[model samples]
Structure formats: C-alpha cells, structure tokens
Target: MKAAPAAQQELLRLQALDTRLAQLAHRLNALPQTAPLAELATRDDAVRRSRAEAVGVLEDAKTELGRIESDVRIVEARIARDGERLTQTSSLKDVQALEGELVSLKRRLSDLEDQELVVMEKVEGAEGAVAAIDDERAAIAVAQQSLEAERDEASAGIATEREQTDRDRAVVAATIPADLLAFYEQRRVRGGGVGAALLRQRTCGGCTITLTGSDLEAVRRAAPDDVVQCPECDRILVRTDESGI
Candidate 1:
C-alpha cells in the first residue's frame, strides 16, 4: 500500500490516541475502589446474617420476659384478694384460711419477681447484641458510600479523557488515505490495539525485534511513500530519521 510520507506518520498519532483510549478503559475497570467495594459487599452479607440472628435472640428474650411479668401480675392479684378477705371475715377459721393463702400467694409473687429480673437482664443483653450488629452495619454502609463516590469520580474523569481521545483519534484517522487507514485498523485488531509503530534503530517497534539481513534489506529497498509492515508483529512500520535502516 502507498501513502504519502506525512500521511504514514499520521498513523503514529492515531496509534497514540488509540493507546490512550485503551489505557483509559483499563483504568475504568480496575479503579482503586473496585476491589474494596467487592470486599465491602461480602462483609455486608455477613453483617446481615448476624443482625438476623441477633433479632431472633431479642424476640425470644422479650417473649420470656412477657410470660414472667404476666405470672407476677396474677400472683399479686391473688395476694391482694386474700388480704381483703382476711380483713372482712368474722369467723376465725375463715380468717386463718385467708391468711394462709395470702402467705402462699406472696411467696409465689416473690419467686416470679426474681425470674422477671433474670429475664430482664437477658433482654438487655439481647438488645445490646442487636445494637452492636446495627453499628457494624452502619459502618459498612458508610464505607461503601465513600467507595462508590470515589469510583464515580474516577470513572467520570477516565470517561472524559476517553471521549477527548476518541475525538483526537477521529481527526488523525481522517488525514490518512482511506485504504491505508483501513489496513491500519485491521492491523490494530490483530496487533493488540497497536496498528503502527516507529521502526527506531533498526528495531521493529511493534515487537522490539531488530531487523536483520533479508528483513533489513526489504525495508531499505522499499520507497519512502510505500507503506510497510513489521514482519514480527504485523503492525505498519512508520519510518523516521531514527529508523536506523
């Protein structure tokens, strides 16, 4: 393929734009927040499970406390009724029977009150467990929010750079001959995003292999306007004063 020397050099500019675009894409995917965000997600899942277990414990403790409270109320009510009967009864036997029942009911109330105290402590402990889990969850949320913000800011900057680089690439590509540009585009796909490279100091810049013997002679015999490819990596070789051919 034949292209003006100036037009061939334009490939170097086009290649630079394409390389910058590729780097920006890679930066977007591998942002510093990406790994940390994934780790935060995993920690969040564990926290969610812990919170669920803590809530279940809290509910059980509350249910036990409720039962103890109800029992204490019933015993207190019985003691109050027996004390009233003892005061109102005129018969000694009735008074004695009411007194005995009052004593029993009071003892039962004391036992129920003790149980209530123990269960209340358990309820407090359960509540603390739930609260601790909540604090951890909140901390994770804050971290995730920060990371997301960082990712967004970094991604936005990379996106802007890529957009501008794309525009520059379009302009550079437009200055090349149609056939040459087409060939370069094909080479880019085949050469890992590098369509053209400067053959500096007898080295094929695309593959870093120094041309020798037959390969060196071929490039030397080619006209300045004749487009050439690096035999090693199949990329268009853009020659300049530093080519050392």
Candidate 2:
C-alpha cells in the first residue's frame, strides 16, 4: 500500500477537491429558494381548496336562483289567466271569487319576487368570492414560477462548478496508482470521505490523535516508501517533514 511522497500529496489535493465538491452539493440542495418553494406549495394547496369551495358555493347559488326564477314565471302566468277571466265573467258571485283569487295570486307573486332578489344577491356574492380566489391563485402561481427560476439558476451555477471540480478530481485521481486509488476510495467511504491524512507533529490528522511512544516509534522507524496507517483512525498517514516524527 506504498505510494510515492508526491503521489500521497496528490491525495491531499484530491481530498480538498472532494470536500469542496461535497460542499457544493450541499449548497445545491439547500438553496435559499427551497424554503420559499415549499411554502408556495403549501399555499397552492390551500388556494386550491378555497377555489373548490367557492365553486361549490357559486353553483349552489345559481341553482337556487334558477329555481326562484322558474317559480316566478309560473306565478306570472297564473296571474295573467286570472286577470282575463275576471274581465269575461258574467255572474256576480263568480266575478267576486275571481277577484279574490287574483288578489291572493298577486301577493304570492310579490313574495316570490322577494325571494328571487335574495337568491340573485347570493349568486353575485358567490361569483365575487370565486373571482377573488382565482386572483390569489394566479398571484401564487406567478411567485412560484419566479422562485423555481431562481432555484434553477442557482443550481446551474453549482452544476458548472461541480463539473470543473469533477474534472480536476478525475485528473488528479488518474495520476495515482490504480490499486492505491481503489484502496483510497474504499477507505474514504468508510472513513467519512477522508482516506489519507498528514502525520503532522506526530498527530494523526484524520483523528487529531497524537501518537504515543510505541506508535510514534514505529512510524519513525518505517521506510519512506512504506505506507503508514494512523493507529487511531485507520487512515493512510502521509508523512512530511512537518510530521515531526
């Protein structure tokens, strides 16, 4: 598992790139528009419900108004027939009965007209409620579109950065030995994305643990080409003059 000092240094560069790439991915996922987009989704649901309720109300009002109008037509037709009969009637008793019926029919008409007016008012109000809900939904839709555009724009920029970082990683990884690179990848997955660390000042950079007498002695005695592992974190120890033996 030995690699040249230069190759080990390349691993450090790779680690830096990996860290930056991870950060970029995190930033892409946690864009500022994400929260607002979520909020917009919730608001859209509420607006849809309100619009449905308003439509129901409007339909009911229209049906009621239609029924009232139908009743008014029937009553008006009856009144016209009775008025004609009154003019043609001959017997005094028949004429008196006809007049009485006419008076009752007119009162009925007045009551029906009043009910119709009330229903018409309800229809108007219901229509207005529906329109208001529609307007609110439209505004929300516009806002959502704007937020989505912003999110996409931010994502595009991050995507470009990630592309460049990935290219750099590929180039750096290519320079390392195949077996070493594969081993590094394995360790990186198991060790939280870090496979190699500098043994700086006798401390394992991976775990920040300073090697003691026996462990430190072993590392100091190891050949320059020997791959040293951090006893604390099990990561490859990249030795340098700054390692302080």
Candidate 3:
C-alpha cells in the first residue's frame, strides 16, 4: 500500500478503462434490433391493420345485402298467399280488399329490391377497397423481406464488433491488479459506475466541480504517477492532456 503515487495512478487508469469497456459492451448487447428492422416492423403492423379494416368493411356490406334479399323474399311470399286468397273470394268488397293488399305487397317488394340495389353498390365499393388493401399488403411484405435481410447483415456486424470488444476487455482485465480492481469496483458502485474521470481545468471529473485553490495546488504538486481522488466526490481523477493544472 506504500507504493509510489505513479503506480497507484496506473492502477486507477486500468480500472477506469475496464469499466468503460464493460459499459460499452452492455450498451451494444441491449440494442433492440437493426434500425431498418424496427422500421419494417412498424410498417408491417400498419399494413395488417389496414387489411383487417378493409375486410371488415366488406363483411358488413355482405351482411346488409343478405338482409335486404331476405326481406324481398318475405314480401314475395306474402304476395303469393294473398293472391291465392283472392282467387277463392266471390264478394266484391273482399276482392277490392285483396287488390289493395296485392298493390301494397308489390310496392313493398319494389322498395326491398331498391334497397338491395343500394347494398349491392356498397358491396362492390367495399370489395374494391379490399382489393386495394390486398395489393398494399403484398407490397409491404416484399419491402419487409428486403428490410429483414439488410437488418440481419447489420446485426451480424454489430455482433462481430461486440465479440472484438469482449476480447479487448479480457486483455485489459488480465493486466489489472486485483486489489486495485477491487478499489475501482467499490468506487464505481458508489459513484454509479463512474469510478474514474479525466481531470480537466482543475475540476473534478465525477462531480464537474472545480476544486478549491488549496486542493488544486496540492494535487498539482503531487507526482505525475500519484492517484488523486477528488475530495468532493471521492472519484479517482485521471489527469489527461486537457487538465489545466
């Protein structure tokens, strides 16, 4: 523990480097997907929704058309039964009543047919929309396929980078002393994994506060190898070329 200040500084530096490398690796691992892949996923969802809405519209139109047809059939049946009753009647008043009923039934049938025509038109329009949606879905599928292929390539590149970084981390870890590593680890946990910071302009890297004039003078006077901790934040301050001592 009574080693030269230079040795202690090197230890702090090694620990800082290891911590930074680990953080970078963690970030690379947590990437969601390739950017293109994420974009394609969003488009895929929208296309599916559009297709579903189109299909739903067509289905509703079909149901309405069916109801109209059923009503027409019922009116026709009523007309037939009334006509049969008229044929069996001999009274003039009864025949006149039968004629009036027949006329009303015919009008009902006409109205039902007109309503059915309107629904058929709607069905045609809905079918057209469904066709449009189908085409859009097909295009989206093709685009998604292309995007997925590109994303796979990008992801593979990122994976390769991650492996290389991991190897670099192993190399760095092997060179670090255990006791110094433990110190760094404890400080990192306490400072939210920011155990080391590059000293610049007499300010503490961890807390971004300028040291008191006395503290700055004391640190400046220390040997180049001295591992200096910021009194305010207790973080190991690694002097860089930018440090305005």
Query: Which runs of model 3 end up more than 4 angstroms from their true locations?
Result: 1-56, 84-95, 167-171, 174-179, 182-226, 230-245
TM-score per candidate:
0.70, 0.78, 0.62
List candidate 2 segments past 4 Å from native. 1-7, 81-105, 177-179, 221-228
Predicted candidate 1 versus true structure: per-residue lDDT over 1-245, tens digit per residue? 89999999999999988888888989888999999999999999999999999999999999999998988888888888888777888999998888888888888888888889999999999999999999999999999999999899889988988888988888888888999999999999999999999999999888999999999999999999999988899899999999997
Tens digit of per-residue lDDT, candidate 3, span 37-102: 567778778878987898899999999999989998898999999899999999999999989999
Q: How far out, in Å, is residue 28 in model 1?
A: 4.9
How does model 2 score by TM-score? 0.78
Score residue 39 of candidate 2 by CA lDDT: 94
Q: In candidate 3, which residue pairs get closer than 3 Å at backbone N, Cα or C atoms, i.e. clash?
A: 5-225, 6-225
What order do you get sorting by TM-score, best first?
A: 2, 1, 3
Clash counts per candidate, in order, are 0, 0, 2
Top TM-score model: 2
For model 2, what is the error of residue 114's alpha carbon versus the real structure, in angstroms, after optimal superposition?
2.3
Alpha-carbon lDDT of model 1: 0.91
Question: CA lDDT of 175 in candidate 3?
Answer: 66
List pairs with backbone clashes in candidate 2.
Answer: none
Q: Could you give me the TM-score of model 1 versus the true structure?
A: 0.70
